[model samples]
Target: MSAGPTSFCGIELAHPIINASGTFDAIAARRAFGDAVVERFPFSAYVSKTITPAPRAGNPPPRLWEEPAAMVNSIGLPNKGAEGFLSTDLPALADLPVPLIVSVMATSAEEFSGLVEAVSARDEVAAIELNVSCPNVHSGLIVGEQPSETEALLEALRPLTAKPLIVKLTPNVAAPASVAAGAEAGGADAVSLINTLKARPMFAGKPWLGAGSGGLSGPAVRAVALQQVSDVAAAVSIPIAGMGGVESGSHARDLLDVGAEVVAVGTASFRDPLAAERILIELRGLDPVAASSATSEL
Candidate 1:
């Protein structure tokens, strides 16, 4: 019956509104909005940008190309690496009032486990979100596509860290629910999805993004996101953090109405940094129990 506040995987979030990992940057965001970022901080819990084991230069220039309603990005998860994040970026973001969900990706189970342990040791980190949806450079297969691979990855990474492990599922998979089931079976504390789909576009007779193909996100994928969230939520027992093309409070509620415990705002953040906050306010006005109960019966 309660709706003002909610807790996901034991982390008490002031509201269900949160940013999708790699979407909002609290550091750079502060420079633009100044005092406003500290005052409201759009997301209830800030999910850090995707961090890798080593430094990455990322894809070549022209990494982002704006489309009509959606944008294509092949940034390739560029970062200063985990060490830099832990030392420099993290300190800058540590003082924020909201919980921090660190997004991490690695090539193998061992590397993933190491990252989990390292990040888990940090007191500022509230949860560890594993980005297993990335199409591996070594194995053409995506980690989140196969249930066996997803389960194995989680099993290896879970034992190395005590912090809550939230696996980010891939929408490109055959059966999104089976992937979520794998995460739960492997002891994942929670699960989130669906990451952007692999997309390709040749804008005006030339390749748009440098990588040729990039993950597609924005309002264009809202329906796919809803279906994926509903499918995964039905298959898993753990809490589901659902997101994709959430642009409005009604869009956020649509995901929640499908069984998502929490909704993440992604592309919308770029259009309106205050979008998540607005959705939170709107969500507060709705009846959480009634909405969830109705969805469960479907």
Candidate 2:
């Protein structure tokens, strides 16, 4: 019973299972599985892939490289851009059964501001998830890597809309808790974390991925995510949507034990598109209240 409902940043959800941006595609899912997929959607909220101000073809080639416990991706945030997203993508996504969170990224503050303003204006958007992986030109640092940069970006965009602002944090930083604290200081409603670890693999004296390095994800990073989630949860009072190596209900519960209000399935979905549903079912079968206190996080 404890698993049936929850509220996140003012939006009601059937459950806390959500997919990582770029991991699950609802429009494509509906195309492949039909309307039933929408009626029985796995996630309570649908997060669109990161869209920039203009269209991008993505990296040159060989963007994905599989590893023992995970995979690396340099696929880049290939998308149809802001204008294309609002016109072409938003219409179809609006038909989903749950709330829609648009994920956006830009090279500059003004560009990011434009994205937040445009997406927030849409009737279909429930919230905006700012992917902080972008580099800050003024500080010569990536937004997720620097606490000050994250705070400044959030400060600039917070006034644009009343919708919830969920900052997606990168796991590359030494102390992600600081970034989460900064995000909170700048008025973020919540935070989704452990975007991926920077990694590179080589084979036969050459890099495996077409791009020399990429972000690593999957089961291997779960421990790292748990630690960071625990740290960030301790650092900020706002809700947290924890994600990294989530594959099953037990894994989701683990994140919840560490104080994540929600858990996102990433690499596991590539293997089983319906993994989220299975995870949700498993999660519901357990006692959510009993599980929440199973661990004392670091």
- What's each prediction's TM-score? 0.92, 0.95
TM-score: model 1 vs. ground truth: 0.92
lDDT of 2 by residue, 226-273 (tens): 999999999999999999999988899899999899888898999998
Candidate 1 lDDT by residue in tens digits, 1-298: 1334679999997667789987888898898778678777767788998999998889986777777878778889989999999999988888787899999999878778778888999999999999997655556677888888888888887778788999998888789899889889998999999898888788799887888888889988899999998888778889989898888777888988898888899988888888887776666557666345332111
For every candidate in turn, the CA RMSD to the true structure comes to: 4.4, 4.3
- Of candidate 2, the 10-residue stretch with the lowest lDDT total is 289-298
For model 2, how many clashes?
A: 0
Question: What TM-score does candidate 2 get on C-alpha atoms?
Answer: 0.95
True lDDT of residue 167, candidate 2: 98
lDDT of 2 at 239: 94
True-vs-predicted CA distance for residue 137, candidate 2, Å: 2.3
